[model samples]
Target: MVNRHRGETALMVSGETLPMRLTLGALAELEHAFAVDSLPALGERFVEGRLSARDIIRIIAAGLRGAGRAIRDEDVAELSFDGGLNGVIKAAIALLEATFGEDDASRPPQPPA
Candidate 1:
C-alpha cells in the first residue's frame, strides 16, 4: 500500500514488508548518480517511463535508504523479488510515485474564485 502522507510505499520483499520512498538525501544521491542538474531533470528523464536496468537499481537503492535501510545497488540487485520482474517494476513505480507523487492526485487543490 502507498502512504502519501508519509511518502512511503509498502512492498513484500523476500517475505518481509519493506517501506520504500525517496528522502531528500536519497534524491540527492540519485541526482549525483545520474549527473542531473536538478531533480526536475531526473523526473523529466523518466517521464516517458523508459528505464534502463541500472536506473532500476539506483532507484531501488535510493528507496531502500529512504526507508531507513542502509543498502547498496549491489545488494538490491542480489535480492529475489517474489513478484518477479513485474513485482520489481511495481515497486519502482511505487517509489517514483512516493517521491514525485502521483501527478493529478498530488496537485494542490484549486481555490474557487
Candidate 2:
C-alpha cells in the first residue's frame, strides 16, 4: 500500500507496481548528483525545471533505492513504462512534490522551538 504520509509513491513498469520515495538519504544523494551545496540549493535546482533524460533516470533510480529496491540507472533507462517517457516524467514530478512540495506551507509542521 502506498503511504503519502511517509512520502511513498508508486511507479508502474511493465504492468508491475514499484514503491518509491525521496527519503532523506535519497534527497542527499540528489544534492550530490546535482552538485549542490545544501538541500535548499538542490530544491532550487529542481525548481528551475530543466531536466534531461539522464536526470529523469537518476531520479527514478534514486526513488527506487529509497524504497529499498537495489536498482541502477542503466536498468532504469531500459525499462518501458505505460506512458513511456511522459509516464516516467509524471512519476518523477510526483515524487518531487511528495518530497519537497509546492512551498513552505507544504512543509511538515515543525515542533516547538
Candidate 3:
C-alpha cells in the first residue's frame, strides 16, 4: 500500500517512525553493495518485473557472498517481502534527510492572478 501525500510517499513500518540516520545508512549500504557486486542488471530485471521477491533475495544473497559477507538463511527469508522493501526504502529516506538537513519552507507562494 503506497501512500502518496503532500508530495512525499509514506514508507513506514508498522506505523512506527525510523531514525533518519539509520534509514539513510541502510539505503546507502544497500546501494553501495549493489554497485560493488555489479548487480544493476539483476536489479533492472527486477524492475522490469521479471524477478520475484525470492529471486531478488537470492540475488542479494549472492552479492553478499561475493563480497565476503555471510548471509544466514533467515536473513534471506526476512528480506523476501513487500514489508522488507518498504522498510528499506523508508530507512534510506530517513538517512538521507539526516545527512542533509530537513527542507525548509521560508517563503510563501504567490497566489494566481
Q: Top model by lDDT, which number?
A: 2
Q: Evaluate model 2: give its TM-score.
A: 0.87
TM-score of each: 0.84, 0.87, 0.30
Judge candidate 2 at residue 91 and give its lDDT: 94
Q: What TM-score does prediction 1 earn?
A: 0.84
Give the alpha carbon lDDT tens digit for every residue of 36-63 in model 3: 4434542443355454455445444443
* Highest TM-score against the true fold, candidate: 2
Q: Of the candidates numbered 1 and 2, which has the greater lDDT value? A: 2
Clashing pairs in 1: none
The worst-scoring run of ten residues by lDDT in candidate 1 lies at 97-106
Could you give candidate 1's per-residue lDDT for residues 3-89 as a string of tens digits?
657788776679887888898998999999989989899898768799888898898889888888888899999888869888888
lDDT of 2 at 10: 88
Global lDDT for candidate 1?
A: 0.83
Q: Write the per-residue lDDT of candidate 2 for residues 9-110, one digit (tens) a residue.
A: 889999898989998899888988889989889888889999999999999999999999999889999999878999999999889888878555566989
State each model's C-alpha RMSD to the native: 5.2, 6.3, 10.4
Ranking by TM-score: 2, 1, 3
TM-score, cand. 3 vs. native: 0.30
Worst 10 residues of 3 by lDDT: 1-10
